[model samples]
Target: MKNFILFLFLFFLTNSCFPAIEKPDDYFYAINKKVSAVVDEPEEVKKIYTRELQKYKKYRTKKYLISSKYVELSLRKKDKHILVYELLKLNDDKYDYVSIACNYNLALQFEFSSPELALQFLNKAIQLDERSGEKYFLPHLYHQKGRWYYNKKNYKKALFYFNECLKNLNRKETLYVASMHNNFGLCFDKMNNTKLAIEKTRKAINILENKPSKTKEERLFLYFIKGNLGGYFFKLKDYSSAEKLLSQELNFYITENYSSEMINPSKQLFELYTITNDKEHLKKLIDFLKEGESRLKTTDRIEINKIFQKYYAGINNLENLKIYSARLSQLNDENTSKTTQELSETSDRLNNFIIKNINQQYAYQKRKNILLTSVIFLAIITFAFFILNIKTRNKRKHDSLERQKMILENNKKMLEKDIKLQNEKIKSLYHSLNLKIETEKAFLNSLKNIKKQNNFQTEEVLKDLLLKVNNLIQVDKRNYDLISECTLQNEYFVNRLSEKVPNLTNLELKLCMYFRLNLSSKKISSFENTTPNTIRVYKTKIKTKIGLDRETSLDTYLKTI
Candidate 1:
C-alpha cells in the first residue's frame, strides 16, 4: 500500500486488462501455469515454486508467495482429477499455520468447483485454529468467506464475515488489512450507507496507497479499491473527484490489462462526462462503450443509457434524442423485466426459508422416531442373535464335519475335470505334431516334383508364396529382409545354423533361406537379386562354414534342425 489520498486528491490524479474479463486472464496466467505444473508434475513443482519465491525473498509477502495459486488454477479449470484432490488432502493433514493457509486457499478454490468442499476445507481450517487456541491467517480465511458471500450478493452475511476479519486480523499485515478495508467499503456501499461507505473506502485508500503492495494479489486488490472508491465518489455526485479517480483507475486498468472492475469505473466516468458536458471525454468514452455492450451489467447498461439520453436531450438534437429515447425505453423495459426477476427471486428465497424451517422440524421429529424405533429393533435383533448363536454352537461340530465332506467331494470333482482337460490337451498336441509332420512332407514332395520338371522360376514364386504360412511356421517375406527374415521364420534353425556355422555372410544367409524354403539354386539366384554364379559362390562359402557332409543335403539339414 503507496499514500494515494494525497496523491489522488492533490493531482486529481489518475490513472486503469482481461480483454472482456472482469479480471485479467494474464493476471492469473502465470499462477495457472505454476499450479498446473504443480498438479501434473509435483516432483518438479518444488523447483518452480522455489524459483518464484526466491525472486521475492526480500519482498514483504515472501512467506505467502503464490502457494495458493495452484489451487486457483485447478479450481478455474474445474479439475476433478485425483492429483489435485490428493495434494489438498496431503496438505490438510498438517495442522500448522502454513497448512491452514493452504487449506484456506483450497477453500477459495473449491468455492467455485465444489462449495460443500470449500465449506469442509474452511471448517477444517477453523478446527485447526480452534484446536491451537491462536489465530493464524484465520482472518484471511474469514475475509475470503466475506468475498465469497459478497460475490453471491449476500451483503449482510458478507459484512458479518468482513467484520470477523477486521476483529481477528493483525494490523501489521497491511495487505490483508487493506483488502478487508476495501471489501468492508464495498459491502457498505452496497448497503447504501454513503457516509459509512465513504469513510471505509477512504480508510482503504489510505492503507493501500501508503504501503507499497507486496504481491501481485495485493496490487490487484489496490487497483480494485481505485475503481470501487471512484464508484463511491460517483454515488456522492462529486463528479470532479469521481472523474479524477475513475479516469486514473481506467488508465491503470488499461495498462495492467485487467477487466470487469474496469466496467464500474468506465460507467462512472461516462456518467460523469455526460453530466459535466465534457464532449471530448464523451467521444473518447464511445470508443470503449461500443465494444463494452456485453461486458456492462443490466444495471450498468440502464445507467449508461440514461447518461447518453441526458447528453442528447441537453443538446436538443432531435434525431439523436429520438435514438437515445428509443434505446432508453428498451433498456427501461429490461429493468422492468429485471425487477420482475428480482421479485421472483425474493419470493423463491422466502419460500425456501419457510421450507427450510419446516424441514428442520420434520427432520427432528423423524430423527426422534428413528432413535426410538432403532432401540426397540436392536433389542429384538439382539435377542434373535442370542438364540441363533446358541443354536449355532450346538451344530458347530456337525456343520464342520459336513463342510469337510463337501470340500472333499468338490476336490474329487475338480480333480476329474483337471484330468479330462489334461488328456484333451495331450491329444490336441499329438494331433498338431502329426499334422505338422504330414504338411511338411507334402510341401517338400511338391517342390521335389517341381524340381524334376525343372520349373525353377515357378518353384521360386511358389516358395515365396509359401512364406505366408501361419506364424507358427514362418512369416510372410514381403519385406525380404535377408538378415532377420530367415531368423524370424525359424529362430531355432537360424540359431543352430549360426552356432554350427559361425560368421556366415548376409549373401550366404539369403542362399540358405531359399534352400530352407525348398527353392533350387537358380531360384535362389533370382531371390537373392544376383547372378547364378554369385549364388553358387555364396552356397560354397556357407557349405565350407558348416563343413557340410557330402552325404547330407543342405535342405535336409535345415529341415532336420
Candidate 2:
C-alpha cells in the first residue's frame, strides 16, 4: 500500500510540472480576429477591441506586464467602452492579478496623458490598488498623474503628486525619488524660481550620489543642473564663479564623451570667453562649436548662430559682428521652418504611442482569465529557470568585465603614447626656432660690417676727389702760401675754400670763401674775382657730390661736417 501511494504521488507531481502551452499562431489569430471586429465599431467600441487585442497578444507573448501599459493609455483616451471592458475582464480573473494591476496602471497612464481626466483616474487607481492591497504601484501612479498636471502647467498639483511619490519612496527605490526631485527642479526653473530650482536639483544630486545604482541619465541630469546654476551666476555677472561651474560641467560632458551633452557647455564657454576677452578660450570654444556643427543636424544651426551672435557682440569686433548678424538672420528663417516640421513629427509620434498603448491595454484585459489561472504554476517554473539563468548570466558578465578592463588598459597606453609624441614634437620645434634665430643674428652682423666698410670708403673717396679738384684749379698754391705765412688768417679759410671749390679757380675760391663767411648763395656769387655763372656751377657740383641743396649756405654744411 505504501508503494502504491508513492507511485500516485509521483504521477501527480509530473502532471503538475507540465505547463499549458499555447501555439504562437493560434494566439496571434485570436488577436487579429478581435482587432478586425473592432475596426467597424464606434470610437469607444474600437478602443475596447484594440485594448483587448493588445492584452491577449501580450499575455500569449509572455509580455502581459508590458501590454497592460496600453490599458492606461486607453483610459487616457477617455473611451468608456474600453474602460468597462477592462474592468469586466479584470473582475473575471483571480489568478491574473497582474492584469488587474495593469488596469490600475492603464488608468494612471490615462490620467498622466490628459489633465482633464487625471483626478478621476488618480482616485480610481488609488481605490482599486488599495482594495487589491497592491500599494507598490501607487508611488509611480501618483508621480505620473503629477507629471500630467505638470504638463498642463498646473504646478501646485504637480508638486503635490511629486511630494507624495517622495514620501512613499524607500531606500531601495531612491532613484525614483531622485528623478522626481530633478523634475521638480525643472518645473521650478520653468516658473523662474531659480532658488527653489537650485535647492531641488541639489537634493537630486545628493540623493543620486548616495545611491548605488547611478545611471548615465542621472549623471547627465546633474550636469544639466550644474550648467543651469552656472547660467544663473553668469546672469548676475559673477563671471569667475560662473566660469568655474560651467567649466566643470563641460569637463564632465567631455569625460562621458557624449556629443549631445557637450553642446550647452560649449556654448556657455563661448559666452564666458567673450565676456572675459580671453582669446585663447574663445579659440577653444570656436573649435568645439565648429566640431559640433559638423556633427549635428541643420536644425541646430539657429542655436549655433545665437551663440555666435552673442560671442560677436561681446567682443564688439566689427568683422565678426557682421558675419554673425547675417548668419543669425539666415538661421532664424531656417529654424522657423524646421520647428514646424519637428512639431508635425512630434504630433505623429504622440498619436502612434497613444494607439499602441490602447491596443496593448485591451489585449491584456482579454487574457486576464487564462493568465490568472496559470500565474502560480508559471511562477514556480520561472523561479527555477531564473536561478539557473542567473548563474550563467553572472559568468558571462564576469568575462565581459574582464574584456572591458583590457580595452581600458589599451586606451590608457594609446593616450600615454600620444602625450609623449606631442611633448617630443614641441621640444623639436623649440630647438629649431632657436637655431633659426641664431643663424639670422649672425647673418645680420655680417651685413652690418659690410655697410660700415662701405661708408668709410665712401668718405675717403670723397675727400681724395676734393683734393684732386683743388689741384686742377691751382688752389694748392693758396694753401702753400698760407702755410708759409704762418699768419693766423683768413688765409687758412681761403685755402680751405680753394680746395673745396677750385674750378674758376680763384674766382670760385672767393665765392666759396664768401659762402663760408655765412653769406647766402646770391650774396656769395656777388663777391669779387668770381663771375656769378662760375660761382653757380661750383655750388651745383658740390651739391651733387654731397647730396646738399645749392640754395643752402656752405657755412652750414661746413659746420655740420
Candidate 3:
C-alpha cells in the first residue's frame, strides 16, 4: 500500500508540473497568423495563452527557430508586456538570437505605423535570416512587406513582393500559392486590370475547388472570389452571366448572413434589369434591395444607399435619386476630410523624423564627412524637406476645405427639412379640401333623397313642384322620360337598381328596371312609345358596357343582383 501510494503521488506531481503538451512550431505560427488577420494586435494575455514555445527546446531546428522568432516578433510588435518577462527568462545564447530577431520584427511592426522603422527592421531581418539560412520565413516576410507597400499605394513594389511569393510556391506550399494568387487578383482589380484580375481569381477558385476540404478562412476567400467574378461580369455588361453568378453569391451571402456580399449583387441586378427594361423584374429586385437595406447594419447603409440611388436613377425617380445622391455626396465629403487630416498628420510626423535625422547626420558629418559630399547631401535633404512640407500644408488645406463642406451640408440638411415640412403641410391641406368636397356631395345626395320621399306622399303637389323646379333648372325632356319609366313595384329592387345604375341616364335606368322586372323588350318599347329596334340597341349598348356576353341573361343577372 505504501509503494502504490508513492507511485500515485509521483504521477500526480508530474502531471501537475506539466499541465499540457505544447503544439508544434508550425501550429503556433498558423495560430499567430490567424490572430493577426482578424485583430490589429493580440493582447499579452492572449499571446501567453496561445503561445507555449517555452515547453520546447530553444534551438530545435532552423524551422523551429524561425517559428519561435515569429512568435516573439508578433508579441513585440503588438507591444505585449509579457515580452519583457519572457526576454529576461531566456538563456544567454537563445537571448542573443531573440534580441536580433525581435529587433527585426520591431522594424516590421513600425512599417505599418511607421514605414521608416519598418524598412530598417526588414533589412535587419533579411540580413540575420541570411546568416542563419532560415529562408523558410522569407516568403511571409516578403508578403508582409508587399502588403505595407500596397497600403501605401505603391502597386509596382507590392507586385514585386507578390511575384517573389509566387516564385517560392511548391508542392508543400500550395495553400500559400493560392493565397498569393488571390492577393495578386485583388491588386490587379484595384489597378483596373480586369483581364488579369479574372485570370488570377479563376486560378484561386480552381485551387479552392480541387481541395478536399476547406477551412472557414478558405471558404470566405472563395466566396470573395465568386463575388469578384460576378462584379467582373457586371462590368463587362454580360448581364446574363453576371446575374447567374451574382445570384449564386447572393444565396451564399443570405445563408451565411454576410452583409458584405449582399449589396454588390443587388446593385448589379438592378443595373441589369434597368438595361433590359424588365419592369416586373426591376420591381422584384427593388423589393430585395429594400429588405437588404432594412437588415443591414449602420456601417453598411452607405453601400445600400448607393444601390438605391442607382436603382432610382434607372427608373427615372428623380426625387429619391437627388436625395440619395446628396447623401452620398455628404458622406464622401466627410470621408475625404477625415482622410486628408490623417494624411496631413502622417506627413507631419514623417517630416519631423526626417528633420531630426538630418540634424543628427549633420552633427555626425561635421566630424567625419568630406566638405563636397556634405554640401551635396545637405542640398538634397533641403529640397526633399521643402517638397514634403508643401505636400503637408496642401493636405491641411484640403482638410479645411472639407470642414467648409460640412458646414454647407448642415445648411443643406436644414433647407431640406424646411421643404419637407412645407410639403407635408400642402399634402394635409389637399386632404382636408378633398374631405370638404366629399361632405358637400353627400349633403346634396341627402337633399335629393328627401325630395324623392316627399314626392311619394303627395303626388299632385310633387308633380307641380317638380315641373316648376325642372323648368327653372332647365331639366331635359329625356330626363323626365327616364325617371317616369324607372318606377318599379318593389322598393328593394328600385333601391338596388338605383345604387347599381347611379351614373346611368334616366332612360337607361328605366329600361334597366323594366329589364330586371322581366319585362319583354317589345312590351318595354310599346310602354315607352318607341320602336322595338331602339330598345334592342340600348340593351346591347348596356350589356357591352357592363361586360356581359349575349349568352348571359341580363334580366336574370339583374334579378339576382
Distance from true location, Cα of 288 in model 3, Å: 2.8
Best by TM-score: 3
- What is the overall TM-score of model 3 with all chains considered together? 0.41
Clashes of 1: 22
Assess candidate 1 and give its lDDT: 0.61
Q: Pick the candidate with the highest lDDT.
A: 1
Which parts of model 3 have CA positions greater than 4 angstroms off?
A: 1-119, 149-157, 169-174, 186-193, 261-285, 318-561
Can you rank all candidates by lDDT, best first? 1, 3, 2
TM-scores of the models, in the given order? 0.40, 0.39, 0.41
Give stretches of model 1 more than 4 Å off.
1-81, 88-106, 112-117, 133-136, 151-157, 212-220, 256-261, 275-277, 288-561
Task: State model 3's lDDT.
Answer: 0.60
Q: Write the per-residue lDDT of candidate 2 for residues 36-62, one digit (tens) a residue.
A: 345334575456546666765656433
lDDT of 1 by residue, 1-561 (tens): 123322221111000001223332233334444554455565566565565556546462422244443333234444534444544544445325445545665675566668777878877777785665555455656766676687688999999988897888667766656766776787788888877887887887788678754555457667668777777788888888878878887887777766445666776777788778888888778657656655666766766666666666566565665665566556655656542444334333433343334436777567556655665576566668778987998799789999999999999899769545643443444345445556666767766777688546875758644852453263223223433433454555567777776567655655675666555667556545678787777666677567675676777676555
- The residue-level lDDT of candidate 2 at 475 comes to 36
